[model samples]
Target: MQATTPLSANSAATAPRTAQPVAARGRLITDAPTRMFHWLFALSFVGAYLTAEGERWRMLHVTLGYTMAGLLAFRVLYGLFGPRQAGLGLLWRKLGSAPAWLKSLRTAGSLTAVNWRQGQNLLMALAVVALLVMVLPLTLSGYATFNEWGVFPGEDWLAELHEFFGEAMLFVVLGHLALIGGLSVLRRKNQAAPMLTGRVDGPGPSLVPHNRRWLAALLLLAVLAYGAWEWQQSPKGLVPANAWSQVPGGEASGGDDD
Candidate 1:
């Protein structure tokens, strides 16, 4: 048989073919405000805890509290109006459910739901609840102490309770930070960085445009400022009259001057 002529060097090039660009890996997850609120709240909570009693520091602490409250309120609104991936409903819907692939009766396949981190998610949720529980009392008590309301005869009990919750919150926060750090290191994932950039990897819905987020953030700032201004201007916020001074023969023994 005659030796087959060697195929031309350009033969493969002439053959029909198709080329498609590979899709980019990773996608955005967290929104801008969500990220900003995370870090800012983290810092403010730490500051408030450390300088809780000092006069000048209390100003910063109070301002930060109002800011944190505003951020939390904004998060609620954003969850409703923002992207699906960042929305509260989406995040929590499948949370308590078994993984879709693993819910079937078929035993022939590996269980996909087996690896779901329900414990971790629950832990995070608990931390959030604890933070809120602690903060509510702490914030209200701070306001009470500020107003000098002396609702319970002496504000000492309220003040102590507020401090107790505040400290408790700090402990939980430290745990949260530790979890993030550990997860990042173990998975080689930058969990902390996402809060700064408000972006995340993996499949997710489209991000809200920066412009919209900016407007939302501005409104948040306005509300926060209003809260702070109100706190400062409210007459009840002045330090309370000392109990000893108000008592018989105890004049000059207690009060702000003391």
Candidate 2:
């Protein structure tokens, strides 16, 4: 079997890259901006989640939550207007084939007898959608909770909902990681490395030509600046005003906490 093949522009446009041995250093399959978004989003969620429990880190938590919201905004704009391969539409297209993929399973004697790769792709698509869509609810509810928006009907309901979204996102994230692990084992290659290095094991021109490192750098800088600004705006030395002694514990004091 051929280890690699030349990727012509025409075939690249026509073919669907359904999770091959996509890892290591070779031709680029992912651009810098996409990779930057992925890592920053992950870090923001993790940092926010870790600091969610107490008053001590409330400001930091709020800042991190806002960071997630901003990152989501960036992702939405980029996916809508960015490169074709990195577009959100690609995921939607994968999801569009779900009906047919599900229909194919009915003919199989056993579920495993069906196209596993196709199923994997569908699951991945679903996971991505879940993660993306959950962000809206997560950040919205988080913002409300931080403001103590409603101490009325079903007191703390918003907080509970925000927590629920966080847990749900965590579940989907774990599943995504599992899918990557399974793909790596099945393909006898480190599938996760491609995401880190934005490359795969092949010899040809990059599928995503522009690395766009400048954009990634700018994104990183923007997030950092925002975090620092939030810190400085807080009443205390570095903590946000809310956490210092404002509305209540876990509440943002004042100034662009959103």
The residue-level lDDT of candidate 2 at 22 comes to: 42
Off by over 4 Å in 1: 1-25, 90-116, 151-155, 202-211, 216-258
In TM-score terms, candidate 1 sits at 0.63
lDDT of 1 at 235: 54
Tens-digit lDDT track of model 2 for 1-258: 868977899987898768777454688898998899899999988888888887778888888888988998999999999998889998999999988888888878997789888888888889878888999999999999988886686688888998999898989999999998998899899978867999888778888978899999999999989988887788653453444444456545457553
Which candidate tops lDDT? 2
Q: What is the lDDT of candidate 1?
A: 0.65
Candidate 2 lDDT: 0.85
Where does candidate 1 have its weakest 10-residue lDDT segment? 235-244
The lDDT per prediction is: 0.65, 0.85
Using all chains and alpha carbons, the TM-scores for the candidates as numbered come to 0.63, 0.79
